[model samples]
Target chain A: GAGVSQSPRYKVAKRGQDVALRCDPISGHVSLFWYQQALGQGPEFLTYFQNEAQLDKSGLPSDRFFAERPEGSVSTLKIQRTQQEDSAVYLCASSPGGGTGDTQYFGPGTRLTVL
Target chain B: QQPVQSPQAVILREGEDAVINCSSSKALYSVHWYRQKHGEAPVFLMILLKGGEQKGHEKISASFNEKKQQSSLYLTASQLSYSGTYFCGTETDYKLSFGAGTTVTVRA
Candidate 1:
């Protein structure tokens, strides 16, 4: 079976430009999460979804960030205005159950570089 | 808040053993472990719930101490494949806060 996957693998955006990153979680996973990893640091949580419901967005750093998991499958994280500080690896993960304690399988992240 | 991991990094030879520890100040519902190599996503290692249960995967095992709000990961007889960064995610509710990470280097 295919594991979770993210698109573009890498993205370079100019400051002030808007960028959208995509994530495809493993088949039948009901819970999906987004995280940001700065260089030499641990991943920081961003948002979470269960099916089509955006259950938690407290981890989102700012209002400029938005995420949607319509139809309970594919998910997208959109940044309205890219900033130099936004440069980091965007990781997506999914688990078999709705609980956050479930073992999460991760995707090869989309590394975003803001120039 | 993110959990605190000890000994920011470690170096070991094949067949050696190492221990990585994670502790949180607040009560924890669960603790999750992950290992990641450079330029790759974090791979799940295991999970320990609040009951202080211990679990193992291959030669890697972990124990959760509910009262102390701490967890320890034991890597026995290390392999080259074990060289990577290990992160512990402390969960209080619906989301997890991860630690700074501990890097492990194994030589054969």
Candidate 2:
């Protein structure tokens, strides 16, 4: 079976440009999450979704970040007025269940570079 | 908050042993361990639930200490395939907070 996958494996944007990253979770996955990983650092949580509900966005760094998982499948993370600080690897993960101990399978990630 | 991982980094030869520790400030319901190589997504290694249960994968094993709010990953007879950055994600509710990560390098 295909694993979770992210589109535009690499994206370069101007500091003020807006960018949208896409994620395709594994088939039948019910839980989805987004994270940001800076160079040489751990991945920081961004947001989470269960089906079509955006359950946790507390990890989102700012109002400029927005995410949607419409129809309970594919998800997108949009950044408005991107900043140099927003440059990092955007990772998406999904688990079969929304339970506490379910293991998350990750995508290759989309590396965004702000010039 | 993000958990704290010890020893930041380690280097070992094949067939050696290494331990990576993760400590959290708050109570945890579960702990997940993952390994990521350069330019790749993290691969799930194992998960330990609240009961302080221990799980193993091949030569890798992990233990969760609920009372101490900590987890330790044990890599026995390490192989070159084990070289990567290991992250521990601690979950209190449904959301998981991951540690900074511990980088391990295995040489022949």
Candidate 3:
């Protein structure tokens, strides 16, 4: 079975540009999450979705960041006005269940560099 | 809040042992451990639910102390394959707040 995957493995954007990162979760996964990893740091939670519902966005840093899982499968994280601080690897993960203990399968991630 | 990982980094030779610790300020429902090599996504290692359960995989094991809001990962007879950044994700509700990470380097 294919694991979770993200598109545009690497993206370089100019500051102030808007970028959209895509995630394809493992088939039939019900829980999805997005995270950001800065260089030499651990992954920081960004947002999460259970099926089609955006249950938690508290981790999102600002209003410019938006995410959606319209059909309860695929998801996207969009950043408006990309900033130098936004440069990092964007990771997407999914689990079969919504339980906190469920092991999450992570995608390779999309590295975004703002110049 | 993000959990704090101890020792920041460690270096070991084959057949040595190492321990990585994670501590949080708030009570936790569960703690998840993951390892990430350079240029790769984090790989799930194990999950420790509340109640101080201990779990093991191969030579790697973990213990969760619910009362202290802390968890530790122990690697015995370490191998070069174990070299990577270890992260502990503390779950409060449904979200996981991860620690800064502990980097482990193993040499022959």
Top candidate on lDDT is 3
Ranking by TM-score: 2, 3, 1
Candidate 3: where is the Cα deviation over 4 Å?
Answer: none
Misplaced by over 4 Å in model 2 are none
lDDT value for model 3: 0.96
Query: Candidate 2 on B1-108: residue-level lDDT in tens?
Result: 999999799999999999999999999999999999999999999999999899999999999999999999999999999999999999877777889999999999
Q: Is the docking of candidate 2 incorrect, acceptable, medium or high quality?
A: high
lDDT for B98 in candidate 2 is 88
Question: Across residues A1-115, which tens digit of lDDT does each residue of candidate 3 receive?
Answer: 9999999899999999999999999999999999999999999999999999999998899999999999999999999999999999999999999877888889999999999
RMSD of 1: 0.9
DockQ scores of all models, one per candidate: 0.81, 0.83, 0.80
Model 2 agreement with the true structure over A1-115: per-residue lDDT tens digits: 9999999899999999999999999999999999999998888889999999999999899999999999999999999999999999999999999878888999999999999
Q: Point out the worst 10-residue segment of candidate 2 chain B by lDDT.
A: B91-100
RMSD to the hidden true structure, all candidates: 0.9, 0.7, 0.8
**Clash statistics: count for each candidate:** 0, 0, 0
- What number of backbone clashes does candidate 3 have, counting pairs of residues 3 or more apart or in separate chains? 0
Model 3: which docking level applies? medium
* Interface RMSD of each candidate, angstroms, one decimal: 1.1, 0.9, 0.9
